[model samples]
Target: MISKTTIDRVFETARLEEVIGDFVQLKKSGANFKGLSPFTDERTPSFMVSPVKQIWKDFSSGKGGNVVAFLMEHEHFTYPEAIKYLAKKYNIEVEETERTDEQKQEADERESMYLVSEFAQRHFADMLWNSELGKAIGLTYFKERGFTPETIKKFGLGYCLDQWDGFTNAALDKGYRLSYLEKTGLTIVKPDPNNPNGTRKFDRFKGRVMFPIHSMSGRVLGFGGRILTNDKKAAKYLNSPESDIYHKSKVLYGIFYAKKAIAKEDNCFLVEGYTDVIQLHQRGLENVVSSSGTALTPEQIRLINRLTKNITVLFDGDAAGLRASLRGIDLILEQGMNVKVCTFPEGEDPDSFAKNNELEDIVGYLEGNAKDFIQFKANLLAKEAANDPIKRAETVRDIVNSIAKIPDGIKQEIYIQECAGIMNVSESVLFSTLAQIGKKESTEASKKQRQEQKAFDVVKNDATVEKVDVQYELERKIIEILLLYGNNTEKFEDLVLKESETGELVLEPESVEAKVYEKIYLDLQEDEIELANERFRTIYYKLIEALNQSENFSLSTFLGSLDQEMVSEVSSIMMEEEKYTLHNWERKDIYPKDKKIGVAQLTSETILTLRCFLIKKRMSALQGETREGTQDNRETLEEIMNYIQLNKLLNQKLNRVLS
Candidate 1:
């Protein structure tokens, strides 16, 4: 477990903008920073980061939280993992107590896989640097590929010895379990013939150079190993098998290194292999990542989509390579991202091209040669369909399919016109084909929606019904007031009922000043009202405790003590009104009434509303009891009359007119 002091220090030292800016491209907007929502597909910037509050909100997705919460949400990190990541980023020393054997055994399965992967990364890196055979072979291969020592180290490049059990033995000796080793695919285990009840283990990436594939936060999720020897029976490159921590289809190689660069450049260079990413990054082009030679998946595209909206796919000039990668362009287009294709000279791929040229030449070549996806596709396919009517017709349909993938109507029409001119076909024909494709896609989409709706209705009908708590919103509002204005002292007017000279009860108003927290606590206690939401109730007591203990309460300090869920709820409530501030209301000739101006009235009204609601509920229960004859008839009658009068008084205090 991480010590409280270390966690506090981390929260203090880590700046919200600096931490989030690593993954998001933030542009200054007044007092806060705004960016396109990483949690959703958005053209407009809806993600707001408030450095003053040390919290961020994605208005698009309705997720708001502090720094640690963002990491947990975006990177899928555990709490301790998030703290450790921040400590490393800010250069703060993490103080953690050693886990007992039982505690170690109780670690989460995903965390265990991560720990094993991290151990493998370190072991391989140490072998590459410290072992003689590793240096002689793996180091030689990397250096021969024109990768510098710094580049290799930066990427955590490493080597595994050729002996079958080298890595497996070392890991076992380190007290790492063989079960995790097999789960992470670092050690391959099989049934042993010599021992009846025992199993044999060997290294999975034996005789290979290792490339650690990391998540966005730099946790080693898996590894890709390239074989040093030319073994015809073995594949050239081997990747970690699917496990609790690693899913290849959802991961992009070099994302940990390239995320910031991709955000900074507002563009990404998509390539085919791990070396392609390292080599390009080594050559000062840092915004490059690889699919690791697999077809691009929507999950991977969404990963990049969080960073930027423009993707320039770098293809080798090989015809087969170009054709295989062209399919990825449509996927990119479908994601509402701009797609450009840049092919290297006839013989050179990104690796060789970057290694052979200076940075300026390579950069200039990319900028000058990159073609729009439509033009690139048309030109490449036109060459193959040259003078063949049937092939050309098929090519036209293929181009139309790519065009139809575009979500924007204007873009599709423009691309269609461009395709018509490129194929020497009529615009009418292209339009007709695009319409047919769009209609077919719409029909398929509707069918899928109907099927989904049917399933949803079945589940909805079969699921246990939950009673909606009508007091929830009122309870939530009261909590919001406490969190935002709890410590604030303001003048409040209280209405009191007193005996007049004629011996009749008359309403009178008295002005008083008190801290908001004190007023709220007294009001709720007087009425015996408790927060209906369990989470809200927990936060309420904590806030009251903080208020009672501290004369000078710090929002940031108080926030650090709460869990992620509370942090999110508090931030949402705090920033709920600030969303209007983002609209620049005054500039648009629309001025929103500021709630802070009547903080006392808002607090008093919220409490009064809750009191009124509870009174009505009591009255209803009394009426039901009277009908059921479960209570004394006279007592129930008197209780109902008292509740009615109390409800009327609350409504009057709330300035509600009687119907």
Candidate 2:
């Protein structure tokens, strides 16, 4: 367990901007910083980070909390992992106490999985650097691919031996659970063919160079292995299957490493392979990430969109996969990303080119060669179409469809003009086609939205009706005042309702528990009644006890007295509004309004209001009573009229004081 001292240091030193800046590009927006939502694909900024509050709110996804919570949400980090991350960021040494075996056994499944994954990462890394076969084969292969020692270590590159059960045996020998190994897909388990009820295990990535896939916070989630040998039947690459912890579709290669740089550069370089990422990073272009050679997914693009809107995708001219990969540009556009495509020279990929040339030269080549998506598409298609009208028409449709994928109207218009210019087609004709596709898409989107709205409405309407009670609102307002003005020591008396022997209303002055809102409400009531807002009411009682028991109260100490949820809610409310300064009123030549000045006048006004309400309530209660000009009812009506006239005079006096 992390020590209290360690936890205190973490909270004390952890800066919101500094911690979040490691993964997200945040631009100053008023007192808070705003960025693209990490949890969704958005062009416009919707994620907000408040340095003063040490919290973030993602308007798009509606997930919000402090730094620890952000880490838990975005990186899937445990509380301990998040604390340790902050500690490391602030250079605070952590102190921990050892736990018993039973206590360790009580660790949650997620934490255990995280621990097991970390162990596996270290195990593979050790094998890569230490094992004879690993050094001779995997290390040799990495070197042959022009990967440096620093690059290999930076990426946490590793290797698995050729032995069938090598990794599984090692894991078991270390007292790690065999079940977890099978669960993580590090080991393949099968029912023994020879034995009736027994199972056999083999390493999943035998004789493969390992690449550790990490969560945004850098915890090892899974592995991606590349084959070294020229085995025709064997697949060239293998990834860990989906498990309780890792989802392949949501994970991107090099995100953990590239997130900071991507945010810093305000752009991300999208590539196709793990090598492409490693090579670019080696060449000091650390803002590059790969889709792991898969088709660009909305999830993957969203991940990049969190860090930046601008994306430059690099494709190799030598590779036969250009046309197959071109579809990704449309996906990028759909996510409202600014996409540019760059192609390396024929017979060269990013990896080879980086190795052959200096970093400056490589960067310059990429910058110079990067072409806007529409222009690249038009130029590539123009070569194929030549002067054939039919082919040109097909190309125009393809470009228009790509433009239709863009969610932004301004970008679509700009791309349309560019496409027309490149295709030698009229802007009007191209726009007409774009309009048709866009209209269809919009109609479908609207239909989906309507369906979703209907579902939402059904759910909303199905909710049980809650009875409206004004008493709850009154109690909440009282609590707000108590929480705001509780510290003031000046004597402030409030009127409480009391009942006399005749059951007539009587006003009594009460000096009650300061900041004890529930007590204040109870004290005011002629009859004892419990207030709603149960959580605050509960807190109010405890605070009263604390205040009565102690000579002096500290706001922070009082705040620290509650559990996490209560603290969060109470603190948020308390800090939402600033203290109204009498200084400002004084500057405007206004005197501080004495809170008690209107008390006598407000008393008459209150009686008048209550009389009106009581008369109505009584009338409702006496609905069956056929009291035709009865003496009691007549006297009640006459008394109410007199009180209303008196209230008019009271209002004039109160208004004069307020003015």
Candidate 3:
């Protein structure tokens, strides 16, 4: 747990623009900042950051929050993780409260696994730098690959000793649980046949160089180990088993280092190994990542898509390897992204090419050699289908199938024309083939949509069957007003309806000045109407308590004391108007009548509206009782008539014309 003082200091020191600008490119727009939405693929800017308000709202996705909330949403960091990230950025010291042994034992399962993985990374790195065997073996291998000491350390390279239980024993001696170690795949356990109820434990990556895999926010999720010895009996490379914290298909090597570069360069270079990424980054081409020798998955492609919409895939000169990886291009096209392909010279991969050439030469080679996916695919397939009509026909069909994956109609037509010219076929023939493929795809898409809609209908029907509390909206509105404008003080006008000597009601408006909180509290107390929603009621009392306690209230300070759910609610309320602000209402010839211009009138009207609603509700209940003949006594009759008169007066004060 983080200490309250440290959390407060962090909230005070971290600027919203400075913290979010690390990941996004924000341009100043008046007093606020605007940028393309990081959460979605948008060409026009919809993400806005307000320094004055210390909150940000992405109008495109409806996500808004304070500095810490943005980190949690953007980086998937837990509350403490987000706080620590900001604290580090602003050079604020983080002081954590000591946890009891019982509290430590009760930690969450996923968090425990992450803790073990983090410890193993440190342990392996220590071995690589400090251990004699690690220096002789792991450090020597990295040096041989032309990896500088700085580069190796940057990637968190490490080594595991060439022993059966070196890592397992170290982790155990440090009081780390074997169960967590095994769960993280850092240790392997096997049953011992020699002794009943006994198990044997060994390190999984013994005798290898370690490459720690990190999430986008730089949390160590897992490790990849390369065996140093030429042992044909063992696999050349080993990876951590899938655990709660690591999903291999969803992670890409070097994303943590490459995300900013990818966003800045507006393109990514896809490679096949960890060293390919490291070597190229060392060459100053920082926008590169690898599939880590696994087949590219849609999840991995989407990860890259978040940073940019263009990808350049680098392949070795081997024709067989190029052909084998050609299918991955269609996956990129399916995601509605532009893809280009580049192949290195014979005997050179990304690592070797970067090592053998200057940075400018390597970059020039890539730019000159990169070809659109369609052109590259067509040229390669044409070579393979030389002088054979049947083979040529199949190549055309294969190219058309890839073209169908493209979602943009204009791009598809352009590619179809390009294919026609390359294949010596007429444009009409290619278009006919494309139409057949499109029809089939449409039918399948319609079927999927129907299934999804049916599931949605089931949920909608279930929700409709439940009774919805109507007063919940009014209660929520009251809370929203309190959170956004509770601390503000302004002049208010109270309209009083009095009985004249002629026995008629007369309206008189009187001017008064007070804080909004004081007016709202007194109004609610006079009416004796409690908030109808439980969540709203809790927030209401909390806001009142905060107002009474603080001499000058700060939103960020108040937010620090709230739980995650309440923080989300408060942020939503505070930023709801920002959407309209982003739309530039002036451009649309629409102007929002300024409610703040008459804060007193707005507050008085809001409270009167609530009172009138409650009065009408009471009148209806009394009418029901009168019809049922359940309460027809003289006193009850008088009470019913009196409520009717009071309802009329409230309606008049609210300027509602009675029918």
Candidate 4:
């Protein structure tokens, strides 16, 4: 377990915006920052971070918390892992013991696989640097590829030995388990009738240079290994098979290194392999990532979409089977992003071009040569259809189909005009083709919608409508006030029961000066009321106790002491209204009342409303008791009547007329 001291140090040193900025691109908005929600697929910025409060809220997914909470949610990290990640980032030394073999064995399957993958990354890097065979073969191969020492080290390139079971034995001797190695696809296990254990293990990437594939947060999930020798039998490159943590389809090769630069540049250069990304980065083009040779996937496109809406895909002109790769551009268009295609000159791919040219030359070439996807597609297809009327017509329709995939109608029309001009086709004919495609797509979409609605229609019709949760809203408001203004001292009006001149019981509002938390605590205690929600009940006393104990309270420090769930709850409550502040409310001449100005009024009304709500609840219980005969009717009736009078008086003080 991490010590409290280290946790405090992490919470203090780790800036929420700086840490979150590594993942999402944040823009300044009204003393806060807003970005696209990483937790959801969104174009508009809904994820908010408040540096003052040291909390973040994703208005789309409704996930909100502090720095650690964001990591836990976004990176899917365990608490300790998140703390360690921050500590490593901020250069803080964590005070914790390393896990023993038994502890490692006891970890859940996924974590164990992670542990093995991380260990394998280190082991392979050590082999690349230290082992003689690794130096002569793996290091030589990387050096020959024109990768510098810094570039190789930056990517954590490594080497695995050729001998079968070489890695497996080394891992076993180091107290690592074979189960994890096999699970991570680092070790292949097969039954062997000649072996003593009736099974044999072989290194999956034997005699290969290793490239560790990482999550965007920099967790080593798997590795890609390239063989050096010209072996006719063995495959050229092998990747760790789909494991619990690594999905090749979803993992970008250089994303861990490229996400920041991509967001900063506001453009993403999409390449086809690992070397292309690294070589480009080495040549000062940092906003580049590779699809790692997998067919482009929507999940991967969404990952890049989270960072930017512009994708420039570089294709190898000299490579075989080039037409198949053009489909990825259509996928990009479907995601509503602007895509451009740049192809290398004959006999040059991204790797070779970067290796040969200077940074300025490369940047100029890319800028000058990057053609819009529609133009690229039309030109490429138009040449193949030369002198064939049917093929030319088909090419026009194909370009139109690609245009139709765009979600934005305006962009589609613009691309349609561009295509018509390029193909020398009439704009009206192109619009007709687009309309036909749109109509067919809309028909199919409506059919799916109706089919899905059929399944939910009966349930929707039979489901009873629920009224607004008044108590929940009230409790939430109370918590919100406590979180935002608990430490604030404000003068409040205290309602005291007194005899009016006519001898009738009435509420007299009088002035009182007390801290906001003190007023809330005393009033709730006077009524002997408790919050109905379990989570709220836990947050209430703990929050009140902390407020009373500290004269100089820090929200970041207080949040550090609570568990993650409570931290998230408190963050959501505290930052709820700031979400609106981050939007364009002021531009429309709309403004919310300043929270500081109405602190006293808000506190008093919440307490009074809570009191009235609790009184009604008790009265309701009494009325139910009278109906069930669970208690004496006379006492129950008298008790209910007293509560009714108190409720009416409290509501009257609140300017509420009770019927």
The 10-residue segment of model 3 with minimum total lDDT is: 464-473
Superior candidate under lDDT, 1 versus 2: 1
Clashes of each: 0, 0, 0, 0
Taking every candidate in turn, the Cα RMSD to the unseen true structure, in Å, is 2.9, 7.2, 3.3, 2.0
lDDT of 4 at 570: 91
lDDT, candidate 2, 1-659, per-residue tens = 99877776677678878888777778876556777777776677767776765666676675666667777777777777788888887899999898889987887777777777888888888999998988999899899988999999999999988989998898899898988888888989999999999999999999899999987778888889998889999889999999888888888899989988898788899878899889889989999888886778888888887778899998887868677788888888888789999999989888788788988998899889999999998898888898899998998998899998888888888988999888888999998998898789889999999999999999998898888664554455444445544434433344545677997555555653343333343344643434457886787676656666665554444543455566555544543332233123567877667544543333333333343344444454454343554445755566555554444433443343212
Q: How close is candidate 3 to the true structure, as a TM-score?
A: 0.90
Q: List residue ranges in candidate 2 displaced over 4 A.
A: 40-44, 59-62, 446-531, 538-659
Q: Estimate each model's TM-score.
A: 0.92, 0.79, 0.90, 0.96
lDDT of 1 by residue, 1-659 (tens): 89999998998888999999888888877778888787887767778888887888989899989999999898878888899999999999999999788987887888888898999999999999999999999999999999999999999999999998999999989998899999999999998999989988889999999999998889999999999787999999999999988899999999999998898889999999999899999999999999998899988898888778899999887747667678888889888889999998888899999999999999999999999999999999999999999999999999999999888999998998899889999999999999999999999999999999999999999899888676987878877887778889999887777778997555688999999999999888987888878989999999999987887876777889998889999888777766666676779998778678999999988888888888888899989888999656998898888777767777877779877
Q: For model 4, what is the error of residue 44's alpha carbon versus the real structure, in angstroms, after optimal superposition?
A: 3.6
Clashes of 3: 0
lDDT of 3 by residue, 548-625 (tens): 788687778877888777777777776666666666777889988866677666778778778878887887887777
Model 4 misplaced regions, further than 4 Å: 97-106, 195-197, 578-583, 625-638
Candidate 4 residue 48 C-alpha distance from true site, Å: 2.6
What's the lDDT for residue 593 in model 4?
82
Q: How accurate is candidate 4 locally (lDDT)?
A: 0.90
Candidate 4 residue-wise lDDT, 242-261, digit = tens: 98898988889999999999
Higher-ranked by TM-score: 1 or 2:
1
lDDT of 4 at 213: 95
lDDT of each: 0.89, 0.75, 0.86, 0.90
Question: What's the lDDT for residue 540 in model 1?
Answer: 91
